[model samples]
Target: MSLEKLDLASPDLVNENIEKIAALFPNCVTESSKGKAIDFDLLKQELSDSVVEGNKERYRLEWPGKREAIVTANLPTTKTLRPVREDSVDFDNTENLYIEGDNLEVLKLLQESYLNKIKMIYIDPPYNTGKDFIYKDNFSKDEEKELLESGQTDEYKNRLITNPDTAGRYHSDWLSMMYSRLKLARNLLTQDGAVFVSIDENENHNLRKICDEIFGERNFVAELIWQKKTGSSDAKNIATITEYVIIYSKEITSLAFNQDEDAHDNARYKYKDEYYEERGPFYYDNLDRGTLGYHESLDYGIPTPNGGLAFPNGRTKKLNDGWRWKWGKKKLEWGLNNGFIEVQESSSKDCGWGVYYKIYLNVDNEGNPKKRSSPYKNIIQGILNTHASNEAKDLFNRTGIFSNPKPTNLIYNLLKIGSNENDILLDFFSGSASSAQAVLKANSEDNFRRKYIQVQIPEPTDDKSDAFKEGYNSICEIGKERIRRAAKKIKEETKADIDYGFRVYRLDESNMQDVYYKPQEYDQGQLDAFADNVKPDRTSDDLLAQVMIDWGLPLSLKIERIDIKGKEVFKVAENSLYACFDKGIDEEFAKEIANDSPLRIVFKDSGFKNDTAKTNVKQLLKQLSPETEMKVI
Candidate 1:
């Protein structure tokens, strides 16, 4: 059978689960009056005692809008991402992305293509400080119509609403906003992926509880305390100097952090000998142990290098009734044979001699010293808030283009620990585009190809603010400019061959017309109105973009245009995908494209010359490359 047009709507997860359960237990699945649904009674019977039933007491984080938040996440949106080539740098080649929209809608639009793809997500969301602007998602309202009516949008039509402490649903509104976005973001993470969220004391506890519920408590990595400043003068009681970075992994066992070695770690390995030079320097640890109880196995003594008998001293008493060597007999013997144990003369009056275990510098199996490094600790100090503000000033060339932008170094360190070369890093709350700058800087330093996807709502700048006066009307303007300036600065400074560019995409209504959504509502007379299925305002590039998303292809893929006969063909990622939205596409054009043997292809349904041509196109492709998947939109 030939392929049909992809359903552009977001996946109905509830129905998907129902079908999955129906597959496992057919008896439990039945058609309800509303439609197909799982019979919970039957399912419980099938599961027997294994399933927990009823409204029993359970450990869960609950709030006023928790249920609505879940519904908002599951509800599909007809929104699409439109490419803005004008706001982009190296649009055709760059793997980086900067998406301007409500993060909740943007995350949902990204769910398909980026599912299980992102290696790391770092977000500095609003900390709910009573004055912070929180996203208000009105699922009931039409996004496009709402923006048009408000008249507050710039060219991109991005909008936001503030959440003030005076509102009755202050905490509930903030929680609701974060809950849906976080839920969708979890799906985009790779199995080894990790998410880092920055927040202050304002909602740290609440954020942690919700994160526990969403990411599972077992995947919780660490709660890092970042010293934002030496101290804050605005504190009422305790002088709060630190904020937190809550880290969680998609899968705890699959995740690992890159260790960085500081001067202090290198100093730990002190002694080096010619024999152990290949293994690097090492330090000695006393082999004596003080025991609270008797242990028969570790009570033995050993012969010293000076022909002296050294008795085990437990440190509590002289070599008499105390415990002995820390290592057991077998390990002690192995260490002695391997030259890992050393005997030295005792300087202390309590013991005759001291036994030492040589702890060598961490090394690989090849006897080469491992990368000098230490595991990332929970406490992150030395980074100051002033450093972040100064970074903003330097980038914008204005005193206050953006306030309190995160230091690029801070994000760079986080990226170094959580990701590697060629991995994708996303920041849905990419205020000031700090993570984007950090990604570029990191890539330049390490000669990597890591990509980033940054999303920020175009929150309006206050008229009296310096940023507004400096020609930035919204937060997104500052973010885009920051990336542009940062990319240029990095290229000039490092001269490294890195992708110092990003494509810009803005969230908007789907390119498909209303007829495509509600085909059953129209009659044959009205069918003429939908001769061109795509919206009139949309370009061929816009339709191609939606096709890319519909097919779960990366938006960063290289696109090239070529003429086959008189019609233009769009080739994406070489031969990974081909789309021709032009009308009157005939059998000859289809054959010309099939000759390229693309993995997948799409075309406008009405673009075909006729039904015969359409059938011929399918047959020709099947004959040429039977494995090729073809779809018509």
Candidate 2:
């Protein structure tokens, strides 16, 4: 087989699914002359009445740019994440990632490798307050050239603008920006994964509608109310002290809420009995039911300890009606036989005796002792914005570096419920990297090896702000510093053997030169001028990054450089992949690599000594390791 270049872009999911279906049922799949277009008519006919088509009145949420939002989500990006080893901590070993770029583009770049891989995502996107910065995705134009010409970008090349309420399409612009990002983010979630988004009253309703459309209304988990603050001094009418966190699951049926052990400890299971030593604490619940609208079968009187029947009555005993036990006859008999029902003399004259059901704290359905815990509640309380602000101030040693930073505890609790040990957590809108700190702290506390990927745009800090004055030109700088500080603090405090470092990557143009993309337009003279397909400034590491992206390999995998026959060869994730991009590669070097029999190997097309040497290497690899998939860049 001849070696071919791998397309370095996100896969077209629709076409991939079509190919799978064709493989399973060849008769149901038909192709057209226009590059294998699916014959929908035959496919539908094969399925008979199992599918619905051409429904004009279907339910869907829409807005001005809804269609464009979908197009943006499907569009492939030519951007790649370039490693910044100088800015990274433990670059060779850490599984954590700190990606500085426009999150929309970053999410698209991550689609291939991270598809259905992330366990939980927690994003604190801009609440769309009038003064907050909003992203404007100009998909119609070249992003890099447009930003360079618009003068809206900082030295780091992050394109952003303040979105005021007076903007003509205030709501529409914000909605469009969120829609595309959310759509792409959903693809990275595992089947049992979930996402939590933080918002306020300004766009809570719109965000809910957008999530309903993207994640499917059936997957809507809960709308959590967080008591962000105790008071709002600048209120016009009502003092708004709460914000919302909308939760959605990839598949609701597969998601389960983790139990809160601390909450279970404070439960009111105070009663003790003869079996308390074995059954643990117990609580008494009322067994009597109201007579009004009561069923006759449930109205039978319950026997009292005083040899009398208990009946339902008003406080003054003005109306005496037949009483009903909360449990049916068989259940009551079971409870009585198991000593779970108790009758005691009542203090009130209205009822001579009280019937009660015993609920044991550590008991199973069969009334045997078992450990139990409580499910976390939707309403999260006691976490205030002031706490988050204090944390930011303490971390930065200054005030106003970042505003309204989320508390690490809040994100820590969310991570606890949404993720398990070793699962991947993502936060695309990672302002100030609070989620990163939370992940680090959680891993240390629980002795877990969980991984995190944080994406944040290097939005320029205000010139007069404290952060800018402190040498932090962009929010990304402040976020990266926070992670370093948090990692050091967590290590010193916990002394845990957990990963407290992250790998740093920045988004940029693909490593391939422009000529590589438009090879057909170049004449022989032009092609000869561009001998190397890769860009001039890109290093061997940059080319390897693109290779990983094209091959759908995790970017955090361990990479090592080894000398083979006095030529440097890069090995990634052990034997998973090997590459040699050095010049003057000979048959001896190629044969040495072939003897290793790696799963995959790549070489620079121009690095070989001659065509005869390349042919010799290929033949040797085919004979020695026929199973190895080899490619040339």
Candidate 3:
């Protein structure tokens, strides 16, 4: 049999890695109970004009648009924040969320609701130090399709595997793992939003390139060089001293930076002149002939203070470097009036007939007066391992488990520059959970409502290691313990009603999908008829619940079901929700459902028998329930 070439541009490339097995290869791909992979062409037809495309994949996503996206001005509501337990991941009223899952999958699920909503994101992913086991994520198009079609949904649930140095595809492995996740994470940032990734030398270079590709090169803010340690090691050929924090923005023009004014250089103000203000201190800086008022012939066309012409040599001459307005006349007048200007004293031999303008401590907060000459170069003072060891000892009540945990101050200072109080900070490769500690400490110090979402795979700790033997079996357990300790400490210090709690949302099999598909044996016609509505492992209700959770809707949202002309219709609120997942929807049932005037109505794209029926249903619903919004599931 001849093989047909697949369209390279088509999304089929996403999961078609497996080679052809037999003549019936296409039919071999089956559908899962959760409906993981359906026909992309069909989905595109259903969600026209709303599909978001990347280099190799297209995601059918929608949003409420700019009207609802805008943060409107309103009277500040009298609200006291609290840490309430939410059974689902909506995060609901809380500003922060703590989700315990593989960030890759979580980020994919978040693409719909959180697209362009995040302002700033901070993540400390695995450094790939060659020792640290990096995540091995290989979710491909074929695997996804197979999982869906077979009604077997555990396909994506692979255990974390170590990427050893012997692995030839180390860079490819790390890139593949990060590529899709970063692609999804990019959607969550606003146009002007920014992201900060923390990495050591191992993958810093790679990360910079990846971020440039994802966020665009011009949008790169800076690659900060932070001294994470003070001491030099004697073990290696060259002592590595710093780690880089890569920063990028969704839109370069939308970036906002807090200007940090530098301390005045006291050496520049050492000239002897007596003047001090009560409010603060003051100093006199000298002016040279090149200053504004120098050549009287230029502005006033008059003579110099020594009595001849304004220009030197008793004749007009060009000013040095054609300098003008070191101090304009109006500013010069103000300086003289305030006793800030000083002409050469009467008896002084080196009296240069030029004017001096006062540089005062008080200056109006206006235009970019001084552009930063260089990036921030302050070497962050990190805590010694002794200090870190002691802190970890206290947390574990013994010698620490991890050897080189970063200090809390190092992360706190980095966070201070980019993160605000209400930001949702994510730490995907949260080791020892120092980032979490920094977030809590910063929140308490400033009373900002910043929230943190940390994800660490349950990689088992070494059984021979002291940390594991001490009862922390996995790295995740240590991470959780660190968070608990950090919260307790923060609570003790701040008497405010701050929430030191975080909800743990772990990655598990989706409740809607089951492992295996076992359709009851029946006639070919019967199988075709029932297959449209009856899933092998999951029911329609399960998929609906998953959709609701993914949309950030509350799980406790009351669901009501009603029967209309032998078809089941689900209503979430009294008159708010109306979902008809029932395939082969009769025309009369559709009309009856429309007459109820629900706020929102959802129907599976395949539910209607034909395009004419779908059109009629949409047309009638608009007339009867004019205010109701319609959505295709």
Give a tens-digit lDDT track for model 1, residues 173-279. Answer: 88888898889999999999999999999899989899998999999998888888877788799898888889999999998776662332344567986776766
lDDT per residue, candidate 3, 5-52, as tens digits? 111111121232222221224433446684323444544444467663
lDDT of 3: 0.57
Local lDDT at 550 for model 2 = 80
Model 3: lowest-lDDT 10 consecutive positions: 72-81
TM-score of each candidate? 0.80, 0.78, 0.54
- Candidate 1 structure lDDT: 0.81
Candidate 2 weakest lDDT stretch, 10 residues: 311-320
Whichever of 1 and 3 has more TM-score, that candidate is 1
**C-alpha lDDT (0 to 100) for residue 28 of candidate 2:** 67
Score residue 434 of candidate 1 by CA lDDT: 88
TM-score of 3: 0.54
Model 2's alpha-carbon lDDT is 0.81
Candidates' C-alpha lDDT: 0.81, 0.81, 0.57
Residue pairs whose backbone atoms clash in candidate 2: none
Order the candidate numbers by TM-score, best to worst. 1, 2, 3
